[model samples]
Target: MGEKTLPQAGQRGAIPEKQAWKALAALCIGLFVTLLDQSLVAVSLPRIREELGASINQVVWVSAIYLLTFAVPLLITGRLGDRYGQRNIYLIGMAIFTLAAFACSQAPTIEWLILLRAVQGFGGSLINPQPLSIIHRIFAHNRRGAATGVWSAVASSAGLFGPVIGGVLVGTVGWRWVFFVYVPLGLISLVMVARYVPKLPTGTSRIDLLSGLVSLIAVLAVVFSLQQGPELGWTWWVWVVLALGVAALLLFIRMQRNNPRALVPLGLFKYRNFSLGAFAVGMLGFTVYSVNLPIMLYLQVGQGMRAETAGLMLVPMGVISVIMAPVLGRLTDKIAPGLISKIGFSAMIAAMTLFGILMHLQVTPAWLLIAIVLLGLANAMCWSPNSTISMRDLPPELVGAGSGVYNTARQVGAVVGAAALGAVMQMGVDSFSFGAAMGNALLLPVVFLLAGLLAVSRFK
Candidate 1:
């Protein structure tokens, strides 16, 4: 089969092999940073609380606020990239992220740290969407699986190592250095993108700033309401804020449907695959991040594991995921994506069920460690294949939008999972049992997997 060709920027010729590799490397770094940030704070949360004198709620925002900021702007940013140029947006985002990391390191108060995390989220929003855009522009369909496989593998493995690395850094250097770790990586990634990322101009439209603003308001209100509801007793004002948020979202959707220069073209949803795939991605993202945060708590706080030891215990899962993700991604391209997705989801179910049962029984450390490793293997298969399958069916024109849309699900899920599961465990709603809270959280992945199975079954 011949390589598929897409239009290039400035009427340039075909993308060269070296340029594609460079773009991939830059993209991998961006993906790694985003995923790393997702879990890197887990081990350090206690330290941050002690140093910053953060309350339970304030500390959660250190994580939740970042996710809310990240998730809310993705679709808008993706569209902005299309309108203003992805390379420029990506470069700007990296710079912002780097600075935000520095700010986070210097933060002396929990509020300051939370604010900096929000800044990091915004920067992350810019960085995360462009990689898929680059992949769509540069790689032919025949090569996309291998290319994206590598991308997915790098991203998934980052989650495995991020906490471990954060743990060690907190134990040795300080928790602040976790934020600083991105500086050198960001600098290197910036150079790669500047040289290799093609500078495609905005086609015709300016960024629909009004639409972006509305989205920001809506998501922020909703996320804030959700995050605070459990603690605040879900008062009338919380409900009011949430209701207003829903209304704003509805209004935003209406605006997008009617606007000539919509931030995200409403028509993208016409693709059955894109719609269903995005849903699956969202649910999967929620389950994945949810698993990371509480598990860290269980290991460190519940079991009294040292930061370094916890980090070491997580290594097997990282290794397994790193090895398995690419393999599953490659499999996604050939055998039915749904079948692969189903298998992956099934693995997730097994992993979560085992985890809940083992933790409930207060199993021995050796056995518990084994369970965590198995969970990693299951996650490896689920995450990569699911990501590959979700994006595979998009038209070239829709690729950039698809990237943003897909990631939005991931981020939103992370926020929701963290907030929702945290509430359950902290409030003792899940039987005052950490194991029960975990079991309840595991149900989310099961539901998402079932939905993925249905999506795959309906595949044309």
Candidate 2:
């Protein structure tokens, strides 16, 4: 009765181990693409600007558009996966992403490239939620941290290599190869999804189209305002967009109360751990996206490093995160998750503070390398275990919707963080000392790290 009700496959009450690894592999592919997309663009941005004759605003938009689109659709798509089928939705997203990559590579104009990038973001939104949703369905609770740890490792490893790979491709072959490079990997993943990614039966609830609309409007308005505010000088549109977004959010919450099949189930937040854990994940997302772009810009412009060289500098951080996540996940089961998360948050704070000091002194390669190592270790500590704790106590039926909400928060936070940080750096370009903008950006991560520590306190 438990096995039948649980939606997990067990032979006379024992979950099979082989299927777990298969799910992990499929998830790794999805994560690799997502993380790779974020980092690969870092080193390639300058080249992209030069070839396409893009201004600083347009260049930044390349990253911005991707993140904004990526964040918006995650909740809706995740629920759609639960309702339609995780396997099917995931495959469709991958197909769209792979083909979109080709379109991005061939784009003859900057406008065309940006447009395609928006399309790419939409496709990406579908990818992030399904893998974790699949994991939640397949893995039993006791072993989930270990599973998430492996998934986190793959994500970090891909993030680590993306810049290096993008740098090399941009320097030797051309920026076009950055997009073209994902082709074979996508093809392989498509095959894997077809063969290994199992399909759950479609759910019965009707799609909540209105709720999805309000959510999207709210998210887009806020994202646009934040991204454009520094550049636009607090225009009416900024205020209007933000106000509309806030209003839309209120409406979304009101609608969710009545809609039985809401995109994000409000009831999931009734669980204290789940609510706090989701907020912490959002803060972590804020830290990562906020930190990454500025560091990339500084590496290339301020430090006088080539795209590839700067990318290689980030290698240590990526490597440590990849190596530590799974190991830490396994340890989480034996130890308390809150302790693990506290340690992780502490590491991140230390890394960010040290990075601030290093940037103030000089933007040297050695300093960057040391900071990367610390950042990677910190990332490994926070993400995997925090994710484990986030969903630890939820009912099985709620996992899919919960994964959607959790992922949506993460994606939305990343978008907001990137926008805010980008604005700070731009303002820093004019208002403060040489290092002021970068230093100001560090405040974001510090605040998030503190918040994470506070949230982890509630984990048990």
Candidate 3:
């Protein structure tokens, strides 16, 4: 298969081994920029709030809106890649994301920044799934685990490093540079994609626009309700929105069941590995997103570390994940992914538990770094293996749909995590000290990681 002939334009064929790896690199560049932007705003949020004279709720919306918009459209955009070309859609998405980043850097008000971030999210939704789908298509099953490992490593590293980069930029140049930083990265990714990523065969199935709209609405409503609930003091409207979201979700499920060309095929759920793997990934997202901000706050606010120093503390997580991902990815291909994931989740649970205890006690930086390193190793173990296992059994035709569904689950988990953590921190502030609040909030991710462990346990 490695020596097989290449496809002519508009068709699928075996990409030569050299070209396939190059394509993976290009895809990873794009993935890195997108994931980096997701967390880049974290350490800079306070600066953004102060500079723009924004209220706390408005500033939180800056992050929440991006997650919400990004999560909502993933179901449809994955199909867009399938029906159109993944390469083409990726290029378009990258372009929009780049342009949006520039606009975000120029925003004169918090509302403008929030609106532009949503645009960035829209672009991100289009780009997120294509790499997974492309990797699934281009690599032989035996080699895919390693490719996905590289993919996971790039994403995880970007996420961990974003705050560091954001801190340097925010502390020195300004927060706007965080958005400006993406412009060059996006251009490099665009060039790489255009030059290396081959045009794959496009699907002919009709897109279920109604089902997609329903799904988007449901997600938006639920995320809005959760994100605003604490800020609004759990108003009557919050429950109303939550109920409406649930109702919309049921309707979306019904629509999916009836449509042969659903954005998310109901039949994909029949595969136990995919279902469980997706759930576990969502839990992973929940843990990461929910815990990250509080940790940053604890380091900078409670411990009185500088933003740059606080950001540097997370370097171990990225470095360890980069080093360990390929090893774990290769291992994933040879072992039962469920077992590896169980080990990973155990590490994560232990790390988070230890982190909470240490933060509550105000331990030395050495102990905190140890916990971060453990979390990084756990990240390396979990992401690639879960992704490889989840999509291993998907038919070629379902790859795009499955990728979309998997990414949607992860992003939705992130949105919910951010919201739940916000609410928890708010409660803590009202009842106790901020440090204690953050420590209490850390326990939630442990619960999420444990839930992920339970999900993966069902995987054969």
Per-candidate TM-score against the hidden true structure: 0.90, 0.92, 0.94
Q: Which one wins on TM-score?
A: 3
Model 1 spans > 4 angstroms off: 1-14, 53-56, 108-111, 427-444
Clashing pairs in 3: none
Show model 2 residue runs off by greater than 4 Å.
Answer: 1-6, 9-15, 54-57, 156-158, 429-433
Clashes per model (N, Cα, C within 3 A) = 0, 0, 0
Candidate 2 lDDT for residue 103: 93
Give the least accurate 10-residue stretch of model 1, judged by summed lDDT: 1-10
Q: Report residue 316 deviation for candidate 1 (angstroms).
A: 2.0
Q: Go through the candidates in order and give the C-alpha RMSD of each one to the true structure.
A: 3.9, 3.0, 3.2
Candidate 3: TM-score?
0.94
Instruction: State the RMSD for candidate 2.
Output: 3.0
TM-score for predicted model 2 compared with the true structure: 0.92
Each model's C-alpha lDDT? Answer: 0.75, 0.78, 0.84
Residue-level lDDT of model 2, residues 1-460, one tens digit each, is: 1112234532221235576677578767876887689878766788899999999889888877887888777768878787777777788888888898889999998899999999888888887788877776677667778888887677556656776888788889999898888778888888877766666555538778989999889888877787667778988878998899899989988998956877777888898878988998888878875686667667777777776677778878878898899999888767975888889889889888887777767657576677788889988998888888888667656767888888877766766677677777777879866565676676657876788789888887
User: What lDDT, from 0 to 1, does candidate 2 have?
Assistant: 0.78
Q: What residue pairs are clashing in model 1?
A: none
For candidate 1, lDDT tens digit of each residue in 1-460?
1323246522232376577877888878977897788788766888999988889888877887777777788888787667666777889999999999989989988988999999998999898888877776676665566667778777667877887798788988999999888899999999988878776534537667888888888877887887678778889999999999899989889998867777777877887767777787666766777776566656766678766776787788888877877776667767765676666667676777777777666555577676677777777666776666667656655667778878777777766766677775665543656655554555445665566556655544
CA lDDT for candidate 1:
0.75
